[model samples]
Target chain A: MPRVDVELPSVLTGLLGVPRVVPVEASCLADALRELSELHPTIDVHLFDETGGFREHVLCFHNETNTRWLDGTDVALADGDRITIMQAVSGG
Target chain B: MGTTAVIGTAKGGFILRSDDRRTWSVEGPLFKGWKLTTTSRTPAGTYLAATASDVYGTAVHRSRDLAEWEQVETGPAWPAAAEGGGNGEARKLKQIWTFGHGGNRTYAGVDDAGLFASDDDGVSWTPVDGLNEHSTRSGWFPGAGGLCAHAVLVDPADPKRLWCGISAVGVFRSDDGGASWTPKNEGIPIVIEDKSCKDIGRCVHGMVADPKDANTIYRREHVGVFRTRDGGEHWERIEHGLPSWFGFPIVMDVPTNTLFLAPLESDEYRMPVDGRLSVYRSRDGGDSWEDASAGLPAEHAYVGVLRGAMAADQDGGVYLGTTGGQVYVSSDGADSWQTLPVTLPRVLSVEVYPS
Candidate 1:
C-alpha cells in the first residue's frame, strides 16, 4: 500500500467538519477515495451521486495532474503523492 | 412561537421571528453557500431543510433552533439502478420542492420528479415508488422550472389519501396510501399545445387542499387557476376577477377559509401584472378575487414569486419572498402588506413554522 495526502476544499470542512488535508494509505486514486470515505463516510454524498459517479461539479487532481485526464482512477499511485479536490466553480 | 418564516433562497436560507407579526427579528443566511430549496417543521416538531450545493448536490439538514443545523447523511435520494429519463444529471435527485405529512408519514416532493417518505420523522427516507414508477412516467417531461414534484397534500382526516403536484407531469392522486397512483388532471389545460397527452403534461405550479372539506382543493397551473370540488376528480377554471390566468402560488389562511394568490402578467412575460405586485384574495373560495396589494410598492416592482416562496402562516398572517430578494408580510389576513428591511438572495421557498 502507498501513502498519499488528500486535500479538500473548505466547503467540505464547513459542511462536513472534515479536515482540509487527510493522509491515507492506498495504491490508487480509487482506493485513496475509498479509504478517505472510510475515514469520513459523510463526505461520500458530497463527492458522488447516488449512482456512485463523481458529482458533476467535483474536480479531482493527482499531484497537479487532472485525474479525469488520466485513463482511470485505477492508475498506479506513489507514496507521498498529493490528491487535490475542489468544486468546479468557486461561487457556484 | 408567535410566528416564524423559514425562507429558502438561491444563496442560503433565513429565519424571521415575530411576536405580533409587526416586528420581526432576522436570524440567517443559514447553511451558508448552499441554496435552500425547501423547508418543513414536521409534525413531531423537528425542523428539516433541504440544501443544494454546487459540488454536493442536495441533502437534508435537521435543526432544533432553526439556526444550528445537523446534516443527515441518509436523506432522500434515488437508488443506483433506478433509471429515469433525460441526461445523467437530470436522472439524479437535484432539488427538494416541498415537505408534507399525514399521520406518522412525512412526504418529500423532489426534482427529478419523484416522491419520498420518512417514517421516523425526517431522519431517514424511502422513495415512494408507486407514483415515481407510474405507467405515464415516460411521457412526463420538464417545464421551465425543470421536472419536479413540488407539492404533496395528504387529506387532513384520511392519511391514506394523497395528491401530488408535479410540474409538466400533472397532478396525481394516491388513494391506497401511496401503493398506487392515478393521474387527476381532468379540466386543466395541458402545457404542450399540439399533441394531447391523456394523462401527463399539465404543469401544476402551486396547490393547496381545503382545511376542512377534503373534497375541495385548488391549484395554480401553467395555463390557468383551477378548483376541484370532488377531490381532484374534475377541475374547473377559477380565474375570475384576476388580471391574468398565469400565476405561481396559491396559499390558504385556514381560519378564515380565505385563499390568496398572485397573478403574473402572462406566461410569455412572467412578471407582476402592469408592474404592480398585487396579491389576489378570494374570500368566497375562488368565486371572485380582489386586489389585496395595499401598502406594497406602487410602481416598477416587476418581480415574480416562485411556487414555494409564498406562504400563509394559517393564522392571520401571510408572508412572501420575491425574486427581487425582498420579503413582504401581511399580518391582518391579506388586508395590507409590509416589506422587510433586508435584501438577501433570490428566494425559492418560504415555509412558516407551526403551520
Candidate 2:
C-alpha cells in the first residue's frame, strides 16, 4: 500500500477552526479527495462547487506543479507524493 | 399629491408626501448617525426601517406617524457567529440588503446572514428557519467577502412562499414561510472551470419577483440580469441592452411586471463601470430592455447603485440611490429619470413607501 502526504494552501489553512489532516487508503487522487471530503465534513461545502468537483477557487498541487494541469484526479500517487490545496486570489 | 413615500438616502432618510400621484416633498434625514438601508410600511401604515447604525447593532425602527421613529431590536450585530472562529467584525453590518412584507410579517436581510422577521410590526425579530439554516450552513460559501444574505422577496399573496438571495451561491426558495429552502438554480448558468476546477453560480445581488405573479422572477447577478418565468426553474439571460454586466439594484413594477436595474461595467468585484451610471428597464418581463435615463446625469458621473439602493413604489415610480452619494427618481415607472438631491455618504440601500 502507498501512503500519500496532504498539505493545504495558505488561504485555506486558517479557515477551518480545526487542524486539517486526514489519512485515506484511496488508490487515486480523486478517491483521496472524495474520501478526505467525507472525513472532514466542513470541507465538503467549501471546497466543492455545485457540480461536486474541486471549486475554481481551490487548486491542488502535486509537488510544486498544479495537479489540474497534470493528469487530473486520475493521476496516481506513490509513497511520499505530496498533495497541496491552495485558493486563488482576486482583488481590485 | 396624496401618496406618502418613504425614501432611503445615503446621508439621511426621507419621507415624501404625495397626492394624486404627482408632486412630492422630502421629509427626513432622521437618525443622524446611521445610514438607512431599506424601509417597508406595515399594514397599519407604520413605517419600519432596517438600518446600519454604529451606536446600535443592526436594528429595525417603527414610525407610527411616519415622522417619529422608535427603535426595535433586530439580530446579531455582525454576520458570523461568535463561536464561528472567523473574522466576524471585518464585514460588520454593511447594509440591510432587502425587505419582505406579508400580513403582520416583515423581514430584513442583514449583510453576512439572513431574513430576520418581525411578526408584530418592526418591534422584534426571530431568525427564519429553513431559508437561513440549511444543512449547508456550516459550509455556506462567501463571495469576495464573508457570507451574507442580501435579497428577500415574499409573495404578498402567499407569505409562505419566500425567496432569498445569497451572493455567489444563487437563489433559495422557501415554500413553507422560510422554514426550509431549495436552491432554485437548475436552469440557471454556473461558471464551471475545465477538468480540474469547478464553478459555482454567479453572485446574486438584487432580485424582485412579481408581487402578483409568483412565477415571474427577475434577478440581477454579478454577471447580468436574468428572468425566470417558472418560479426560478429556468432562467433566460437578458444582458444585450445593458451598459455593463455588473450592477446591484433591481426594482420591479407590480402592475406591469416591468423590471428596472442599474448597470455598471463588468467588474466581478462590483465596481462602477467606466464611471458611467445607467439605468435600464425591461417592460416584457426582461425579454427586451431599454435605457431609461432621460433627465438623469451624464454617464461620466461615476454614480453606482449599491445593493439595496433602488426601489419601486406602488404608483409605478422608481428611485435609486448611488455609492457616489446621489439619488435619481423616475416618476413614470422607470421609463425616464432625473437626479434628485446631491450625493451623500455611500448609499447602501433605498426603499419607497407609497400611500
Candidate 3:
C-alpha cells in the first residue's frame, strides 16, 4: 500500500473537526477514499451522496490534476502523492 | 443558568447564549460556509442541525453542546430505486426542512417533500413510505419555495397520531403511526389551485399543534392564518385583528397559551408591512391578534421571517429571527421584545435550549 496525503477542504474541517491533511495508506484513489472514510467517517456524507456518488460541490485532485478527468479512481498511486479534496466554484 | 440558541442562517449558524435573556454572549458563524437550514433539540438532549450548499449538498450534524458537531452518515434521502435515480426530476432530498420528535422517534421533514424517521435519535433514517408515496403525490408541487415537507407535529398524548405540513401540498394526518396518511385541508386556500387533485396545492408556511390539545393545530399559510380544532379535519381563518393575511413562522408558548406569528405585507412582496416588522400574538387561540413588536424596529425594517425562524423555549421565552439577520426575544411570552445585539446573514431557523 502506498502512503498518500489527502488535503481536505476547510468547508469540511470547519464543521466536523477533521484534520485538513490526512495521511492514509492505499494503492489507488478508491482505496484512499475508503480509508479516508474509515478514518473520518463523518466526511463521507459531505463528499458523496447516499448513492455513493460525489456530492455536487465536491471535486477531487490527484496532486494537481483533477481526479474526475482521470480514467477513474482505480488508477494506481505511488507513495508520497498528494490528493486534494475541494468544493466546486458555486455562488450566485 | 440561561438559554443557548442555535441560529441557522444562509451563510452559517450561530450559538447565542444569554445568562439572562437580557445580556448575551455569542459563538459561531460555525458550520462556516454551509447554509444552515434547520436546528432541533431532541427529547434526549441532542442538538441537531441540517446544512446545505451547492458544493457538498445537504447533511445533518449532531452535537451535545452545540460547539462540536458530527455529520450523520445516513440522513434523509430518497432511495435511487424508489424515486429519482439520484436527483431525478420527481424526487431528490434537497434539504432537511424540519425535525419532529415523538418518544424515541425523530422525524425529519425534507425537501422534494418527504418524511423520514430516525429511531436511534437522528443517527440514521428510514423513509415514511405512507406519506412519501401518497396516492396524490404525482400532483404535489412547490410554492415560491421548493417542494418541501417542512413541518411535522406529533401528538403529545398519542405519538402515533402525527401531522406533516408540506409546502404547496396541504396538511396530512397519520392516525396509524405513519402507516397511512390522509389530507386534512378543509377550509385552507390553495396556491396553485389545481382542482383535479383537491388534497394538495396548499402552501403551508408554518404550523404548531396545541400542547394542551393535540386536536387543535394552527398554520400560517400563504393566504392567511388558520386554526383547526378537530385535528385538521376542519380549519377556519384566524385573521380577525391581523393587518395582513400572509405570514410565516407560527409558534405557541404552551405555558401562556399564546400564539406568535410574523406576518409579511403580502405574498407579492414578502416583506414587512410598510417596512415595519411586527410579530402578532393571539391569546385566545387565533380569534384576534395584537402587535408584539414594541421593542423591535418601529419602521424602515423591511424584513421577512422564514417558516422555522421562530421558536419557544421551555421556560416560555419566545425567540424569532428575520431575513435581515436580526434576532429578538421576549421573556414575557411575546408581550414585548428585545434584539440580541448580534446580526449575520439572512436568518433561516432558530432553536433554543434552556440550561
> How close is every model to the real structure, measured as TM-score?
0.95, 0.70, 0.94
Each model's lDDT: 0.86, 0.65, 0.86
Error of 1 at B5 (Å): 1.1
Model 3: docking quality category: medium
Give candidate 1 regions above 4 Å deviation.
A1-3, A90-92, B86-90, B193-197
Residues B155-195, model 2: lDDT tens digits: 77888887888876678888887778887865556642223
**TM-score between model 1 and native:** 0.95
lDDT of 3 by residue, B158-236 (tens): 9999999998888999999999999999898777666477767888889999978999999989888899999999999
Please give the ranking of all candidate structures by TM-score, highest first, separated by commas: 1, 3, 2
What would the per-residue lDDT of candidate 1 be over residues B1-355, giving only the tens digit for each residue? 4888988888888889888888889987787788999998888888999988766888888888786778786788888766564333446788888899999999999888999999988889999999998877767778899889999999989999999998888899999999999989999877753244477778899999896987799999988899999989999988889999888989999889999998888789989988888899998989888889998887898998888889998887888889999999999888899989889799999988752
The regions of model 3 sitting more than 4 angstroms off are A90-92, B84-90, B193-195, B314-316
Q: Which ten contiguous residues of candidate 2 chain B have the minimum total lDDT? A: B81-90
Clashing pairs in 1: none
